[model samples]
Target chain A: MADDSTSNTPRDHGDKTIEFSGLVCPVPLQDYPNIILGHGGGGKLSADLVQHVFLPAFQNDHLAVLGDSAVFQLAGVQLAGQRLAMSTDSYVVRPLFFPGGSIGDLVVNGTVNDLAMSGATPLYLTAAFILEEGFPIAQLKRIADAMGAAARRAGVAIISGDTKVVERGHGDGCYINTAGVGIVPDGIDIAPNHTRPGDVVILSGTLGDHGMAIMSVREGLEFDAEIRSDSAPLADMVAGIIQVCPDVHTLRDPTRGGLSASLNEIAAASGCGIVIDETRLPIHPTVQSACEILGFDPLLVANEGKLVCMVPAESADAVLNAIRSDKHGSGAAIIGRVVADHPGVVVAKTAIGASRVVVAPIGEQLPRIC
Target chain B: MADDSTSNTPRDHGDKTIEFSGLVCPVPLQDYPNIILGHGGGGKLSADLVQHVFLPAFQNDHLAVLGDSAVFQLAGVQLAGQRLAMSTDSYVVRPLFFPGGSIGDLVVNGTVNDLAMSGATPLYLTAAFILEEGFPIAQLKRIADAMGAAARRAGVAIISGDTKVVERGHGDGCYINTAGVGIVPDGIDIAPNHTRPGDVVILSGTLGDHGMAIMSVREGLEFDAEIRSDSAPLADMVAGIIQVCPDVHTLRDPTRGGLSASLNEIAAASGCGIVIDETRLPIHPTVQSACEILGFDPLLVANEGKLVCMVPAESADAVLNAIRSDKHGSGAAIIGRVVADHPGVVVAKTAIGASRVVVAPIGEQLPRIC
Candidate 1:
């Protein structure tokens, strides 16, 4: 694990060789040799990277919580007890425009959703753009306009922005990073670690639509029905859930490594087992068909507008009803439950009445899905 | 200005022509025919791009103020009267590592300083990284360590982070975007539009060290003395100044297009004229020599750790004292004063007793100086 490959001399590890001059390696290289796309895929690899690299360097009481967003209080007389949530995500989806949504919409909705997952009322966002030198100004304007529309729909103001242009060919046309700040109302505390053994898992909507939408565009494969990205804001739906059940244990948006990743994270964070019935998952027909064609599993595919919630069994019905009342969460359904046995694991009951462990993907099945 | 170049057919504008397919342009393209390096140089071109593109798209009450950070209040009863500041910046400097500082330090300090500029006590930060595939993980750890150290020095916590990797050749090693949130104490308000006719301009320290440091390393030019980047955090100094002079009108860091750009922005935003004595501008001798050799104007060169402050004449002495007491501002000096004549213009009093208009650079004198 202690791979000292950045020395003046060349060093070989397994099948990979790395060499550099006049630079010292500060942290030990563990597991993977070099950073692969999967390291950013929010799966086992992404988690490993965070555990070994980022967490150690930036460990703090707030970050250690590792919720969708960092929740903290302002330390001033006027702002005492004001809990704020902040989160950031960078969007680098290929084929900037896709069915039902564009990268612009994804960037805004993605960060908003992350903050929403923390049970916060997202208020303002900051956007930064990294554009290729020759990127069309017209396309930029379109993206910006789309972002504006999305922010308006989400009821969040884009209060600050920065733009940088890399030399042509150094970027994929454009990439955007948005950071959002939201307020967590009193009595609403949601985090992965808050999950309890008696919590019921509810999914807000269909899965795989967002991932399949991007995949279809990239692969040029078509089905009888068009699949659109489920890229919509979930803050209102989340607010409704909190209003109905303020003791909601956890909330997660299935993005990047998708449902499996989110479920595994919650299980690990809470030291509880999650059991889901595969047949109960709400997947769109077109998305299911596309996933079949692409050899993808809907369970591991991304969804931008969907969320998974963990609430006490007694409050499950109320939370589900609140979620169903929202347009974005009309398809909400109960899919699973948390258990004390088999802690830090997730199990799926198959249609054939057999049960199997549902493992998080090591990397991304669909790169840049969000 | 309405350049509809995203149509399937080609379109020509003056000497430059642009053509795209299947996309519609939503905003008018003005000034520059295409996105250039200058658009991200933080000079006039950069300002034009924001004025024409970003501002129109993301215009809001908070954003329209155009302070270093957006200052706003939470809408809830618990957080009422609590004003918060948020700012974001992206660092894409070449040769990731340079004398006295690296991109890691810049990423942390840059955002911290921006929040400090708004008279906010820097509190939390979120960082997102876009890394190129095949980049050494060991180097990444080193950068992460540097970021951690810088955050510690700035007295801020990096509470959240996201990482994404582009395929090799699609990125220049790494680019980091950091967004910071800070709490503004009651009765403290700082913004460019608050500048008044009787405000005295004070500079914290010497200029051009950061840009020159990067330039010296990039150009492989060795001078008699090593030019180190003054990439230090200014939050503590700012807090001290605010404590002494709560009514400080404006604060700006001389980053990307440097002092010229910052002064020009204050002049334009406040509708006030600024007159600076060139002889009083504090500049390191080595930096001056480097600028002469590189044909770069010190006024147009970037400084990572310096700040320009605008305060009423009565508070100038106290503010200067507050600044000078801090190590980062030991060389604090009054270089200029705001004037009612020639609003929206900045002038320099040359050593020969003659004055000349100091126009903001049309583009970056030194690209990626930050």
Candidate 2:
């Protein structure tokens, strides 16, 4: 069986030498003899699979960028001036319903957030559903209703969709894949590779709330205070930030592998080091207590309605203020800085003023939490 | 249990009065208390689910058009001159590999054909994969390789993709959802509602090959002649047809529920009657015999690479010639015509000179045939 250990020790694959190009798969195959749940985990195994298998198969200039969304200019002179962004994400969160959200709203907000990360104004979405044969119609109705409401809230239309039913045993209740298309406004180019030394990393709100909420339901564990998912759309907040800081280096949602994964990815792509103060990281009291009880690290837990922005130090205060003004960004804080030392590494400064390397999870810490 | 009968008797829902607007769910719910295999069969049940459940939830002008794709303009003055087409489909074919194609190629061609039906030049495709835990990596690689090859053949790029793994028994080996975006060329407007009276309906090639190819492998049935799937890309052929007949009214690929369903959909959408000569359909001899032995109606069996075109009488010859000249359209034939009488119904003239109403199948004839 694949290792289920939740160790924080950095793995060998978490190095700067591993890039998108010229990846050899046999080494990773030796580590993973068969597909595991961690392959879907947004961690080292997931990165290895994507870099070695998918990237090589579907290699292209746009995909090589590996941003949250693929932004490109539509061919032909008619659409030459307009750059469009397209993104697809499959939502397979178990338990369907959580404290604050369900798969329905999660899918819409997830794809919308993906487009927003690229500085695009999400316009349309396509929802494709894979349903189990015996799944309840009433639940399906509720899910669809939530999706429609979420789309309206995000100011985008669910213009196209598809449905397929698999045998009861062949599928979960339902899996939704929402693919979104948006228009990238002029004079805005945001990507992970844009991160540079002296960039300030600002995080939007409390970590571990979303992941902990799902775990609460799955494990039937309740905290002293209720922990609800922080799943909300972020396009408006992204627009606010871009208005104030157009030259923002990178924007990412701390989702699957949480803040640590996003930080490591940006550092590797931009050849910089990210250093965050553990004391400055935002955490909800209930979420923090729950993580402590569950022996989980808040830095490695997923957050649906959060963003990590990297901007030049000169504009850090402006970007931070812009994020703080949005409804979803009230708890935003400057938690980290990009530096020239230790490229492709993320370090945390503890309360004792000692630094420790914060490694991305090797596999899923909480399976299907997103 | 829900009805499994593949009766061709006209159901109550197959009438012109059943429009997309103001649809009530209780009526269809009575017919199907729960989703069955037929809900994904692309037959009357599938149509009812979409019209009652999905359409009502995601109501919009673009979605109401109900063409193979949703075509619209981006919301800005910058892209006012360009019209874009977007489509999504999930491929759940059994026995991933069939005689002439696999789920990989089927997914790529399926979305490409969907965009082509809107008279759009397919550009970029996003593939989302739902893989079952413990699935073979070699098979995954093979599928990815096939997808890349097929995308290259269709002249489109697989720019963005997402992968998620479900626990064993929660999924089949793999299910792929492909969402595509394409550009609708100038001066070309194609939609199911665009079919007008006196338009000539043309069949691109033989039917039932793709469906039978899967059945033969799935059931371990052998025939004298192998029935290879007629799975090929139709974008280039569609482009050629547009070059010859830019005013083509409607173009549809008779997938899932096949030619009869496509005809019924167009007839209802256009408020026109369709009459086809049964003897004129181009069916491969092996596929015809297989359908006969399997007690399947060829009219409702799926075709992957074929197209049904509706053109004005003046442009019929040019369109037919263009289709015939293409390699995939070698067996193209003029099969039917639109009539002013009996709107929302299809009639077939038997080889014995008798006329009979051709009703869409009520449910699935062969499940999981893509």
DockQ agreement of candidate 2 with the native complex: 0.48
In model 2, the Cα lDDT at residue B254 comes to 96
Candidate 1's displacement at residue B332, Å, is 1.5
TM-score of model 1's chain A: 0.92
Off by over 4 Å in 1: A1-30, B1-29, B78-80
Tell me what fraction of the real C-alpha contacts between chains A and B each candidate also makes. Answer: 0.58, 0.61
Worst 10 residues of 2 chain A by lDDT: A21-30
Q: What lDDT would candidate 2 get against the real structure?
A: 0.87
Query: Tens digits of per-residue lDDT for model 1 on B191-286?
Result: 998999989999999999999999999999999999999999999999999888999999999999899999999998988999999999999999
**Number of clashes in every candidate structure?**
0, 0
